[model samples]
Target: MTTISTVDATKFKHVSYLWDDAKAAALAGDEVALFIYRSNMLGADLRLTNYGGGNTSVKLKDVDPLTGQETDIMWIKGSGGDIGTLKKSGCAALYVDRLRSLENVYRGIEFEDEMVALFNHCIFDLDSKAPSIDTPLHGFLPFAHIDHLHPDAAIAIAAAKDGQKITEELFNGEIGWVGWQRPGFDLGLQLRACLEEAAAKGIKLRGIMLGSHGLFTWGDTAYESYINTLEVIEKCAEYLESNYGKSRPVFGGAKIDSLPEADRKLQAAKVAPILRGFCSSERQMIGHFTDDVRVLEFINSNDLEKLAPLGTSCPDHFLRTKISPLVLELAPSEDLSDVAGIKAKLTPAFEAYRAMYTEYYNTCKHDNSPAMRDPNPVVILYPGVGMFTFAKDKTTARLASEYYINAVNVMKGAEAVSEYTSLPRQEAFDIEYWLLEEAKLQRMPKPKALSGRVALVTGSAGGIGKAIAKKFAEEGACVIINDINEERLDGAKAEFVQIFGKDAVASTLLNVTDAASTEQALDNACLAFGGVDIVINNAGISISKSIADHSLEEWDRLYDILVKGQFIVSKAGIEVMRKQGFGGDIVNIVSKNAVVAGPNNPGYGSAKAAQAHLTRLMAAELGADKIRVNTVNPDAVISDSNIWAGGWAEGRAKAYGITVAELPAYYAKRTLLNEIILPVDIANACFAFVGGLLGKSTGNALNVDGGVAMGFYR
Candidate 1:
């Protein structure tokens, strides 16, 4: 059954191809650089290509150093290359002649690994990165440069029922159409045949339109290929917008007739956390929402579940996003006006969604098939609330969100000209469970231990605290940098945001001893991310004094900042974790003096000891909730501390009858390891505790003092 959308191609100006820039760079004789520049120029536009979803190649001249022979190798963007920042290292140089060896072989229903091994075997340089799965398509083409991408506009038209006929009419024989097939041996041979067939018919081929997959554009120069890509894509965009669209929603949902925009966005936020819980994998889920008018409208469309069943807009997205999003049956907005109300109403809906997913898998699986994937829903559509996406980690959650937003946009665009035509259920299964895609997943590096977790590090404005926060970020955790010093806190936030990116870092001013301040900070952290999973107790200050000389104020301050503050923060954090229904971690930073006190530091030592004991009690109590509590006690780290930077170090050194600079050496010489215990050492111990290295460890203390004689643990 075919349907028609009244939008037709109207004259829209061509977005000029970056030919001038490419020409200038090529004239300077840097062809490889030209390839990267052209690829990035196209890739930077999300409408043209998505993250990690495109490949580009250029034929580079190579001189054999050992044989003095001249040959050519095509340096193509490799498997893991992200073209946005692609450079020389992102490419794999494959010998063109070696790649031709597997051209005509008959592959009879083979595994994707065999083809991948063949591609790996054809590498011209021993140390070059592995070629991408689509390398053969680029190599077989004689053009000097090739660009392949899954542009939404191009794919929207390619997935329409009038696909090939409309493509021929639009490009006027400039683009060749290749029907959908899993990318491998057969696709490569057919790609070459498609171009040859077009050329033999006296047609000038500019690019290849892959049915239900993507597009491939080629040229004698990088500029020509990149420009052809932009021109054809622009053509598709104009055709959809000018002819069929009466007026598209900002993204692709039906406009909410009853709710105001603010109310709709509010409703989406209220529903986000509930869905996050329902869609969580082994790790808790992170939810991201977008009420792009189009998406909001799409979800509000009459019978959204029926419409969403149209399947993935493009096959490239099948792995990250399943064939169709799980559209939960939402209740009326008035019944679920608040967050708590919505969560309660949606609880049963989530259970039903999972049950259906299991049923779908059972019906789809063969006896020899692999086990079903995690039953958690990755994509969800709801009425009035827009679309929400979930994943085990924040970045994946964000990607899933944007992917669906674009998908809805593309599906609507296709509908503007013709109905959204999708792949058959079996075809979707073939791609989703395809050995090649699975192999790609197997080859990927394991995610960081804390990849999806949220960590809040107190006193992170400097030294030990900053190091711990950095370690968490490196392990893929979203970190919150908390501190009391405004200047230092802002500076640390800027540096962390620069290093780890915007969403991965957040900052808050927290006075650990104040209950209201602690609660406020926790609220902000929860608001930024749906919940807090890990909290680090690192803020402390100590004054050197004899027990008799210690003032009441000095004792109170030590206890307040070091002990009471932790209790306040922990109380607030535990509440959030319990509400989220996931276990968490609390790491307290104590001192070696907790076990072995030095003279004149009675107040500081006692406070630390109390903090350590408190850690044990919390660990024992919270274990049932899945929250782990631990402590890292270190000897003097004055050389690696922000707290010790002022009068404390000077006063301590004076008491020892030595200069302040000699304090680090004094501590180092007393330790058996004779090492300067840096802040990172403490951070590593904390990682061992909360980073899942010692999952069985709780109610324990790890000494990171480099084996101090007095601080030695049995």
Candidate 2:
């Protein structure tokens, strides 16, 4: 057993409280605000605790309506609150006596709904937030302040095989212990009983350690309880350090050489997009990577199978990480960078993972028979390649990754002290299938229109291109903006930041007419965001000339920008998308003039005609690969656009026998709907194709000339 020999207080943080901050909080007028501030200080350190893993409570005087007397009421961290970013409204208040009275009735009640019904009735103010599920424990303890957390260092001791014995030694007889029991009414009663027994012995306890769970500390002020938590956790950390904390062997049993650091990252990069595409569900998959040495040690070990079946260190992790991570095996011939090789291994591995998950779910869910969710792996492991976690969104993916990082650390620490341990598999199942947790999942916000997808928009510096790029980004797609205009491209990047934030937008200069330049630009898009799933081929330039007057050079230049540009970008984009094995879109912004003939526009119309025919040809050939190629023929957009800013619009207005300012109304009145075709209107038309609204219809031209009679399909 491990025992703490001396109290060296200097090892812990000493600045959670300052007089100036406390006074300012008080003077600023809200007491709950003060708790929020203090809670953040405690949660700021991951070594101390994680978001939603701890609760803090403060007791304050309030008038009891029935008795007309002042009594103490409790304000504790609410169930939905994150201590790291708690607000004044995030605290839940409950009457002390009212909460304690339910403990007996709660003792046998294991269902969250039943307890929640009772808690709702007992809310101190009736208008405050719902109290935490651990409310009973905090309420029964007759303390002015209480803080409960599962700090990594402290729980490292609590999760060991001889956790209770080690905790006794670490506390040096200064703390009380409660035996292992699932939290709820029974555990609360047990903690209260232990306190009563300690009082009978004339020993005033400052803290209590719950075996295989966490720790609790209470005091006269927020600062007292907070500091007590820090000191006790430090003692446990020191105890572990003195024992077997140095140079611990990790990575369950297998031994494999970790790839060179640079190779490791490159491998991750190669497989990340494939992993993203393997998800068969409508909800897109987003990936997160971990390379911490402890994680590396565990994944690289030969005995991965031996460690995986033990389950998570805490049941709370079941909500984010599930029970255990799925392990992926690498073969001798399959290198991470080889697209076909990576996919060959992952394709079967993915199917096997889902099959195993399905078996686990069916075995555990005989009675409830709830609708089964898609069997997607939250955590995936490859021994030498590293660990990758997948989630429906970036935030959830990051959370699952962080939890596993902490998990390996805690598991490692417990292994050093004794045999590492986790709660029973059935216990984890209970938490994972808990109705309350299920309800939380049901309440998760709907995925955004373009969630977990990426789009590349060329010619996106201004006008129609910028509108399309902004639209894609607004719908939650990661966007790569490309344009030939460098200054305007930089300007678009800044404006996009104001609209979409920096993470969603990546900008690069693209010369669409040059095959090599276009290939590099599209490749940049894949690197910027895993892979490109949407390609908007909107880049073009126009030249006005009659057939006889058009010189060979002018005709060549016009075709290069209008027809060949679309081909070059689309070709490169499809290479990446096809390797990804995910169906994608290529939206060619052809003009209405492609189908309608006009005077003095022979070169421009001919190039547009060629691009339109090219779209149908590609769609026919690539449909087998699941790629949908479509064209939107927008007639005339009258808003501020590069083509119309000076040269093209002025010349077109003169051709129409109207002033530049009157040309919009001239074009608008000519259309059936008599509507102005703004750049956004064209963008909306293009977005329709990209967003899958035209799912079953592709290889077709949708004329966006406000119902042109001549352009309508016969």
Candidate 3:
């Protein structure tokens, strides 16, 4: 049998005691502010709890809006709020008296769900957000301040087979225990009964270890409660460390060695898109890949087959990662470089996982249960590589991976001391399909048009390219902004990070005319966001010269950047999109000159005409793969334009027999609509083509030239 070694005490000791007396004193009179401070402190550490997994509360006397009298009110972390980023507005304030009175209406365990709806009537503040199901758990407790957390170390003890005995020995009766039950009115009642039973025996209970659930700690003051929570978790860690001193191997030692770091990442990049496609069987999913040492150790271990099948013990872990991960059925000595072989093996494994999930749903479902959700696995484990998680967006996918890492920690701790246990299959099903949980899922806002998609925009450091990238980011697509200019690319990246967050944007220096540079850029996109679904071929250069004056060098440079650039980028990007096994979009940023004939513009106009025709040719060829190719032609977009800034404005003015300052007016006057074109106008046209509105239409060009008569498709 495989066995685990003791935990390093130093690992737990690293969770610092960060409470500052001066900071606490600064908010002495405001109990809610104090509560927020305490919550923030605990949530700032993932060792304490995973993101959005814990709840905290402070019972205080506040003026009741309806009665105009001071009454006891409980302010608890509300539904769908993270304690780490919590605000006063994120809390649910409820009347304690009204909450306690609900015990009279509580029928039994079967009807506990009914209590959730009644909680709205107990609202002390009309503006309060809806209460989480855990509200009753906090409100029923008598403590002035309370915290319920799913710390990895604490859940380790809670998930162990001998958890009750370990709890008694470690806390010496200070912390009590309750059997596993789903969080609701019934479990809240169980908690109160456990505390009362301990008190009747003359035991001073400081906290309670929930069976296969989490830990609860409370105190008369906010700081005291924070300290209590920390103390209990630290004690649990110390106990585990003492029982099993680091002497034996973790997870029964490694069955297979991990690949080299670079090789592992390459393997991950190669397989991520295939895994993403399978996981997105129900709906499109964004992907996150991690080669964290902890994950690699577990997946490479002999106990992986034994432990991973049991699933995660914590609700937060399983809810995000699903009951169990889909483990690839590959041999320890198998070569990972064969991506096609891996794909062939994954297809059957994926189907089996789906079958298993369907069986789980059908066996455990009840009449009132929400319909079965996507049966595809959220987490996929590769032995030599690491972990891959997919979700509706990048952040969620990343969070799922983090939660699974937490689960790995819990499993290590539990197995080190005693046998590890997971929540029963039926219980897991009930929680996953709970009506309240389904309602919460339904309450989520509709996803933006470009949600879950990743886009790569060339020449995105400024002007039309940047505008298009920004618009894609606004619609919830992760964007990789590219340009040959390092300074402008960095500036644009920083600006995007500030507005859309770092996770939503990435930047790379790309010379689209070079095949190797284009391939490397696409590879960077795959590493950053799994794969690229939208390719914007917007990079260009201009040379305004007549047939007699045009130099061969200048003509070749124009075609190299304007025509061949789009072809190279499209070719490389299509390879990635094909590997992803999903359809994608390719938008060519051609010019109005592609259709309109003009003098002194032979080099620029001819190259653009080639780009326009290339769009149609690729659209026709790639339609079998479901990749759409389209064109957006804009005329005289002088604002923030790289081409205009690079002397194209002066050349155009000279051609039109006008001053350089009159170029914008000159171009607008020649248009049928006489409207000045802007970068955002071009961006909107790009969005219209790929934003699902024109999803069925492709191999077409929409001119954004304010209706130039000569540029019209005749």
Candidate 4:
């Protein structure tokens, strides 16, 4: 099995997208589309993380008719449903209020029991499987769509010693941290309280960290929610992976015995009921043998506690078993008869573990009666014996075993770098009981700068072009959205007007390549509003053509729209900007091809190259005139406009006769940071440049292309 590295630079390049209200509304109103979109998004979210390692949900509440009951419901992805590849049946429907109620009662109950009860309350919408352990977390949120992921990059940083402090320093207000909690009711309560407090204090919460668990993000729309989560995680992951994520250490394992075939079968039968019981009545009966000699030896290791706690990665894993059982470590050819000797040697250890558990329980005793639970250590490791996970149900046992096994492997691999040190023991304890921190989280607020601006975006009809325009509108900008196609232009305008008030947004059909037409459009925009402040020159096209077969006409046609169009619109907007003297911002959507040759698409590449060069020229001349000209070099933006169906990397792999599976790493291997650059990545760059952090950074190329091509200073 592949171990998730603490510093896998390869994991930092993916982009996240969130669905906004408009998109959500579209999905909700269109049953067929909603089905497609929701499933598509779920599948994507799951694949983005590891098995049973992420969470996703959709808000399904609506007002009641007549006798008004604000019955809030959320259709959440079941615990095992991988968001990246979920079906409709994978979601669970839970009453939000009911789920939220668990928080209020949590203080009196142990967190594990409380969470299990809360999960049991969820009623599957369809005849689906049991809900995910993260079900309570989904039911706790008010967002329409919620997603959580355990990205390698984010985990590396979050799992490190002093992780909380480091996360606070890096993400600041843009993200929140919840330390670590066993996934379930307790975590849900913590998250809910955090959201409430954030709202009360007006803390714009962009994302939340579950310490050792993973990351969570939400949006009114699935795209926005997904994207925001992706962006924040990607940012942290990329930063950490580069600077602090890589820490390899050296370690060795001891040898132990393998269980006999007869004993292995007997053990599997013994563990079957335990696994089945924990998996929520699922009768999944398949079982695997752990008779491998290596497994036995490792299980017999003397320092299991020093190796880990409870033989699991995180807590709350008791859902599968009362405890992890150790295999009797013995000789390589040990048979069932050796069990007596193994048990004798380890009997004292078991007794000690039970005594410790009772002591812990005694310390937490209070007036309110608490539910009794199993007193045994949930998991035990014997250096040379194969580990055993006991559950009432096969599925639960399997999940538990898989999780612990993976955790052990990850620890073992991580031990290769540096020994994994979670947040300090006291810190972990504090976070585990941190009700105050839990009560401090709030959903992220809308952008302040975009609250009152009336901006226009060219190419506001499709793909990245429309996405930028829609983003501005969502942030409260009075968008003068435009497109070359009248039909698409009208559709987008209608959508925006409906979303941002008809009075706040407008649309026009104009060919940006036509200088005269653009000039007229600019006048109309000024006449309609006062003036445009942010000019996003995203109106452009690309065509695949080899230089050998390419004609001057092809080059001119591409340039006329990509380069000259930017010039025409920017020139017109600049005059109005100068009159107002408000210091306007212009974002030129350039590509990596501007710096590195695009090979086959010479016409498109040459024009983009010129446009990139001209961006510096404009910056030089426009600085005196109070206009900021910046170019966004997007690399391999995975969208319908490109040949890639899933993403550019995947598409390129197919073109090169390689499997899509090989692309992410292959592309990552080519870059210094091994990151895949996305359009939203460019959008973020534009946001920063337009926000004016660059100060005197005009006439410079910001390397946003995953460090693929670094341009020299002119």
Candidate 5:
């Protein structure tokens, strides 16, 4: 038996006090100003934590000088305040004793009510901000100064399958693992129960593991607790790096030599987008586990389900990695870059996973059923092709991928210990089918502009194309979304119905540039929803060209799609919009070049001009027919929208002589209103023009350009 000795206090006692000069100064200042400073500090460190990933609090010890009676006047981190840019109001001050008392009767209580009760018992002289979900977790720690962190290394270790054992070895007997569960008061209650049990058993439990969630460490002093927590995580990371952190293996589970060169190159290109998609969401965890042997092995594994044993790392991760990866058995004659074929192969697998997940949920409970999550894996690691993460939002997708990477390593280590003791299938089913989580999955908190409307967006495959299509879908509109990128198109198809329900969505892969293809796509839309009401002419591309140096063929090709393609689709859609009787919307997505002159944009600008004028002419003709036509002129929407163009970060960087870091002000300041418009911003405008609000608006060009082109607007 190994008996641990208390270390010399000197080694861990570098700074016993919680607040140093800087922190104290900030805390002493006006509450609002202090919060702002704290928030910025928190924002700067990816490891200390990411936004909403952790919590912090200050215990105001109030003492009557005459009586010497001291009481804890609590100021806790507010619910939803990003610690990096914390505000004074961001911290909710609840009476410490009331919070402790609430814990005694908090079983099965609703989360929101529990929070309200905490706010009601406030003692601090500050506006009551809703307390953080981890308020109870904060309350559980009996400290004057407390802080919690979801440090990258902490998550990286927590993601491991044998997390408890690894955490024990790294943090030793000083830490406790609370198993996996949802966050909020329930988690707080769980942690308290564990602490009470430890006390009864004559065992001391300090830090805690919230299972797949993160970690919590507290102390009487802020700096002491913060550094101690950091040290514990750094040590755990060091431990893993020393032992189980093996060399990242090359992707060699399958023979890529059989694949064609073009296909291989395509797959290589696809790898970055998938990886980027994952990392983009959680930038704080940059380069943490981009390449891991277990991740690679799991990607290459025949039994891929083992990689995602207990579903996604959390809800945000689910958005990126989806439900599972698509496993493909490369045939002798198959071409790897046969993008369409690869998509076809994966479709059935995705459907199968969906079916299995649905069945698992249905069978687990005889009393109630929950809505199903999107039938997609947030972390899809495609063997030799590497991995891809998907999410409705960029930040979440990246975090999901990180979680997946961490989870894969943990599972690998745990398997080495024994068959990894995963939650039972029934338990897994219960989580997957949890009613509250299901509600979040099914409910949209706010109504979308195009809600209840049906739209058909052509070229809804990838980049700007997919963003627009998704924008419409997100606004509660059932979309007949089309795209040439069949794999992505199909993936979106599966997700749209999963998110919006089967009755609200339909998808097909068709090239809008082809007249016949446009006609067929329009027909599909009409067939799916009984009629098509809104048509977003988003199927266009740019050829980097100057008229002086560009070939005639390239110039003609740009016109073929940009101008001619819009004509074909809009013409076809008008027939359906008329038949539907409800006045329809036609939004021609044109570039800033249509109004603002720029060099080397001859083809793109000219084609867009034609489309813009066509919009006016169509509006004039379609107006009496009760159909509205408008132009959505957007200035450089920073996204994967512009084809193989570098990407949002690159474009913003190039435009302002700075990296994506300086882009908020750099891009925004350039605009008259200093607005850096996003794709969603443009989509909402388009929805307005097409929906009831703009039913009376027509024949006008709406600049969704964030005041970048004021002169052209009038």
Candidate 6:
């Protein structure tokens, strides 16, 4: 019998042990629940495994629904599911007897991929998710519970030059070793053969380590399996730490120094848009920027040039980060404030990287391989700056950078003790463009209309501005919500963060009338989500007074927020959009009063007229750059309107000789359609202008006022 030892809590420094006895006890007797519990614990720590990187399994006996008899069943994580967020529905249930019977008709290694289709016939539950490619590996294992993890400490040893010899000494012959092979039926057979050979030599092996791969551990019970995995990982980490402490001047010492925090942010802002433009040559992509300590350390190292070209050793790391990264050729001490000079140098670097990737596809692609994907690099490294990652959305871009950081840790540990080895070019290409992987990609849901776009909506804390921001987020756009009211801004941001996630929303206190505040707000948008693609000039104030009663101060205040404020925000947003080299949308929230000659509304009406004309002027001037400028004319949007809340309702009621409670009915009666307009009506008009429906139309005015005939454009 294989001995399972409990790992001492004090022995673990690199990874945490988070198993609670009470939590496990509450989940006893149900094997699937215990399996999910154990998987979540292991996946909670980044030091143990990355997102969607590993697999776990448990075998149990259950009554067959059709046969009315107890039968063996295997439940494992399905393909494309993250272990950290695994649920009961995410597990794929297969008949163990039928799964193991495939060995009788198995052809040679050349026909291993054909075995994947056979696993479908062994499904015990018709509603179970599709089984992962590693299904057979768990099905053929002799243990009742198993865990195959890709921890950094274990991979560091697995990727070293003398990994096999080191594994023999580290576990004292209790663990076995297997050479590199792509995961499939053949790899499962190799694992089974290694276990048999160990038993033949009178050895009770606890686990096995695969070269240039990861670790495998098992036990008779769920708790035993969890503890055994922790023990093996802790031992590997302790050994690596001892050897790494003795080796100083790691990565051959840093060759460059990192920039100061403020300066680094400034440089990153300047370069991120340029990089985003180059990456979006094929399709629009969202970008993420980070100056993490480990990323900066790797960027400043001397061995970066040598090691980065070799790419990542683990399959999970390369799948997200691509086979390799594009390193910018710039000295740490170079003047980074020169935006034009940086773009000039980056042009050739990006061109060269694309050419190299195209060649790689041409050399390694099989006849039936999936077509070459976007040739742009997913990850980019700057010598003095940090790292930049691009993808179809913000979360994926951030995860790609995180996976690359994990690869950096593996490289650091491997180089400390022995030479670090990456997977060969052919093997890396084979896994990246595999047919099964292509099928999985095809199964992903269609992207939303505004999937990779970013929007900046002023005064978004309440009223029409808030509604517009929510709509943008629902359509897959990242939103930067800004307002002058701190209390409302915080509340609005919290609501959006809860619904759309933190990655999709950012908040800033902005006074659009102030030039400095306006520019800084735009800068915040760029830093939050690479650059701004949509700008909604919705911040405003209202005063319903005739020319004789309106003081000069009242007129100035109205013009400052409604007219000049729009100008300041649009001018700043244009600068950033031009830098991104992509067209954008500017939707000015002008009122229907701009076109109507109404009584007791001189100050508000005149300022809105100026804003309306500004939209047309900007549209005519910016058409060459493809930036569309349009106006949304909304009337009597009383519900949740900040303008109405600030004494505007009483003023309008007084002007019409009616009580404040009768304002909604009065406004509705004035419209041709007899309909009461709401904030969502205004929001829908804004979406129609910027939501790609009117992509070819610019310098347009859309009215959402229930057909106000007098306010119609001439």
Per-model TM against the reference: 0.83, 0.85, 0.95, 0.40, 0.55, 0.97
Off by over 4 Å in 5: 1-51, 62-70, 103-126, 151-172, 180-206, 210-213, 245-265, 268-298, 301-305, 309-343, 365-370, 409-714
Higher-lDDT candidate among 1 and 6? 6
lDDT of each: 0.77, 0.75, 0.88, 0.57, 0.60, 0.89
What lDDT score goes with residue 13 in model 2?
54
Better of 5 and 6 by lDDT: 6
After superposition of all CA atoms, the RMSD between model 1 and the true structure is 5.8
- 356 Cα displacement, candidate 1 (Å): 3.3
By TM-score, highest first, what's the ranking?
Answer: 6, 3, 2, 1, 5, 4
Task: Decide which is better by lDDT, 1 or 4.
Answer: 1
Candidate 6 yields a Cα-based lDDT of 0.89
Clashes of each: 11, 7, 0, 64, 31, 0
lDDT of 5 at 326: 47
lDDT tens string, model 6, 51-133?
88889999999999998999999999998888888887998999999999999989978898899899899999888888998
Error (Å) of candidate 5 at residue 477 is 13
- What is the per-residue lDDT of model 3 for residues 298-319, given as tens digits with 9 covering 90 to 100? 9998899999989988888888
Query: Per-residue CA lDDT of candidate 5, range 1-714, in tens?
Result: 111122233443211222235664656634334334443554456545655557777665665344578766677777666777676767777767767777556557444334544546544554767665567777766765556766545555565566777777766567788887656677777787877877787877657776655677765554445455655766655564454424422222323323243443344333322232222222211111133444556665544544454554433333234444444444424453444455456556556755775665566763765544454444544454444454433344446556566455545543433233344556455555656445555654655566545678777766555677677776656678778778888887787667766655678778767877776676555434435667888877666555686678878878888888888888877765544344678888887768876656677778888988988889889887788888888875765565435243554365356776676566577678888777777777776676567678888777776677542755
Across residues 277-368, which tens digit of lDDT does each residue of candidate 2 receive?
77635466666676667778888776567776676766556567877787777732245557787788678877887787778777777476
- Residue range 1-714, candidate 4, lDDT tens digits: 111122243443643333344666766664324533644554454224555556666775555453467676677666545655666666666667666666666664354543554555645344645666677777776777777776555554556555667677778755677867656566776887777777787887777777765678877765556556666767764564354324422224343334565654444333322321222122112222343443443454443445555333333222333333443333433342343344455556556655664554465444542433455443434333355443322234345555555454334433433345443343333333334222222222533556435466788766666677666666555567788788988887787767766655667777988887786676556434435678888887666556776678867878898888988888877765654444667888887778675446677778889998888889888988677888887766554333243243443464455787776566556677778766566666766676546756676556665667443333
Reference-based TM-score, model 5: 0.55
Model 1 lDDT tens row, 1-714: 111122122322533333354355554577888888888877777887778787899987787555779877889888877786787788898888778777655465455447778887678777787787788888888889898988788888888877888889988878899998877766877889998998889987889998877899877776667766777888888877775546543334443453676666555544454555556645666656666776766777753655687767576676677767877666536554354665676677667766876776777776655667777778887766667677766677777777776677677667777667777776777667766667667887888889778888889889899999999999888888988889989999999988988878888998999998887777666545556789999998978788898889999999999999889988878876765666889999998888986777888889999999999999989999898899999877865687685467876787678898798898788788888898899888889898787887888888988787777665
